[model samples]
Target: MARTSVRQLHVTVLVLMLGALSGCTSITKHIGASPSPSVTEQIGVDMHYHQVLDTLGPPTRISALPDGFAFEYESFRIDERQLGLSPNVKFLRWFKLAYGTARVARETYTLVFDSNGLVKAFGNAREDQDAGKGLAFQFIVTVTQVVDTRYLDEWPGQHAWGVSMLQPLPVALNREQSLDSGEHGIEQRGTPTSSGQRTLEWR
Candidate 1:
């Protein structure tokens, strides 16, 4: 119940942001501004990747590919359900919804630049990589989903939440590498999950 309500709220907020973004299309941005800016003009036609980073800083999501890499800028709201909250809220809406205590996090937006420092070729050539897939480059992280679709890259792995917060939640590899699934709460898309582990491989 709590997770449901939280998702509904997230949808509501996203709808509102979309409505606002509609008016800001082609909106150019500079550095140091709050909420950053739209990702299109930052990396589209005639635009270079370095300029995007210069104006937007590091991308929110980054992934590697066969020949080049991809840059992804994204924003998300990690819900209580994502952190293992379904058990307590299964049949108690009033207890959790009316009086639930789940922390919320926010991000403005991200900028994605391709390996050769160019814009991606997608229908929304103007829209940021966060809204598109088939990235010839690196990562893609959104409000409810994350995908790593690349070739020739040495992918990474993760532990079962690790034994300590001392270690990263989904630990990363040295400077370059790093790293998924479950019915406990998360449902794997495009692929089935094994009993209790998420396998790693190059795409």
Candidate 2:
């Protein structure tokens, strides 16, 4: 099981490497080549959509436009693995000796374009932020039980659950310069979730 997991991991990473390599080539070929659409390079609202697509690509998401237009782009990373031994085997080594391996991925992006072709904004929306007026989450989840546990006669004796979380952060690639340039006005926090949850889960 361990060997097989390692092999699978190797294959998965190989596939990702190929994908990245291919992306580099394709991305470069299109660079500096997209046509300047009518009203394409404007930085204001009400821009061109086709030029945006030529510059970026099909939006990952799109808002229903009863009156106006908006679009978003999204991407994700997926990891998977298989672990060893069976729960019913009545052997601790089953789980102790085996567990699958996978990946912790971080390649996702989102771009929201208002009706006027130019990018309204771009970000990864898989975050807890009131500021995320445009971003959206793109993630995949797979749930599975250990083989031994599934076959074991003692069912649900030791209840347990798994949890996962992610947060988005961006680092400046250019010189550090604030719009204020001279002063920093920051808001201070008083507590951590400090307020706390008002309602009980059971209630």
Models, CA RMSD each: 17.7, 19.4
Q: What is candidate 1's CA lDDT for residue 48?
A: 73
lDDT of 2 by residue, 12-84 (tens): 8886554332211000001111212332234234346676566666543344332344553333332334433
State the number of backbone clashes in model 2. Answer: 13
lDDT for model 1 comes to 0.33
Clash statistics: count for each candidate: 7, 13
> Which candidate's lDDT is highest?
1
Against the unseen true structure, what C-alpha lDDT does each candidate score?
0.33, 0.31
Question: Can you give the lDDT of residue 145 in candidate 1?
Answer: 18
Off by over 4 Å in 1: 1-42, 78-115, 122-197, 200-203
